[model samples]
Target: MVTRDSAWPGGVPCWVDLGVDDLDRARAFYGELLGWEAPPGSPETGGYSICLKNGRAVAGIGPKQGPPDVPPAWTTYLSVADADETARKISAAGGKLLVEPGDVMDAGRLAIAADPGGAVFGIWQSRAHTGIGLANEPGALCWNENMSRDYEANLAFYRSVFGYDYDDMSANGFRYSVFKVDGNPAGGIGELGADFPADIPPHWMAYFAVADTDAAVAKVTELGGGVLRTPWDTPYGRMAILGDSQGAVFAVIAMPAGG
Candidate 1:
């Protein structure tokens, strides 16, 4: 299992959170599904719930922001050395800042931005609070990836902003690459080909590790969530896409040993 007590390296996906219409329901849903414990958030931070697994920070759930038409969604955050500098790079690289760089109390500073293709993600400069405490274990974050409609433009944008290097994995008509940070796999980028629904916007996907993909999918249904895709086996794991009761999407994977 991967664990960290401090900030992650720059460009690594260090955190993830869900913005939901009903914070209590989201907290309960994930608590039961992933064996997490979510306590009420401090009022100073707008009651943002932090989900914990094995007493370690795992993810967050907070009241939805933006217009009512904007559905609840999950966001992946990359660790950065300087959020203000990263926000500048985002604008220079043709991306838009949804939330300008600002401090979250004394916990940290952050900014939310969207790529040219409109995939939204966050950049975090850690302070008193580091990112997630545990990962690559059941009930914790396992992976993150960007699915982009304007594949090449988004790729260029990320490389320009974060200096990401990628290993091309495109094959059999699929265009995909694993982005690396400091010579290690950090995340991935994949083309949302013609087959994907046009209404689906480009976005970052966060995956949580599960011990049993099939069982977890069943639990999601039992908890009133819907399955976007049935579990299927890949070389790395058995995985499925799912939406929470409020329609926030995420994936769950049961990795092969040591994967």
Candidate 2:
């Protein structure tokens, strides 16, 4: 398990948050499923709730801030040394900024951007909030991955902006790679082939570690969430995709022994 008291290194995926219409329902659904304790959002921060696990910050749940048609979804935030500089790089690398770099009440400076492949993510330059406090443990964020329809363009975009090196793991008909920072695996990028539904746009997916994948799947269904994929074992672990009652998608995984 990984724990941190300070900001994550630049280029690492440091946090994941969900923006939904029903803050209370989202809080309850995740609190029950992942053993999180989320206090009511305060007006000062525009009703943003920071979900905690074992008394440490794990993720955030907040009211949706975009257009009315945009669906509720989880967003992955990558740590950076300078949010403004990263925003510049994003534009230079064929990305579009949805939100310009700005401070969020001194918690951090942030910018929301979409890669050429249309995968949206956040760039964070932390201040008081240093991102997730715990990870790779049950109920904590274990992984984040970007699935891209235009793989090559997105790959170039990230490499240029974040200096990420990839450890390709493609085999058979699959095209996948792990993005690394200083030789350590940070996240993943996978090519969304023709088999993927055309309507599903490129997006980053966040994975939460669980003690038992099947149990987590059952709990999700019992909590009024729907399973998008059944639990399946891989060399890494058993995992499944799920959608919350608000239609926010995320994944849960039971990591292999000593993994």
**Global Cα lDDT for candidate 2:** 0.94
Candidate 1 pairs with clashing backbones? none
lDDT of each: 0.93, 0.94
For model 1 the local lDDT of residue 151 reads 89
Alpha carbon lDDT at 118, candidate 1: 86
User: How do the residues 157-210 of candidate 1 rate in per-residue lDDT, one tens digit apiece?
Assistant: 989999999999998788999999999999999999988888878999999999
Cα error, candidate 1, residue 157 (Å)? 0.9
After the best TM-score superposition of candidate 2, give how far the Cα of residue 190 lies from its true spot, in angstroms: 0.7
TM-score of each candidate structure, all chains considered together:
0.98, 0.98
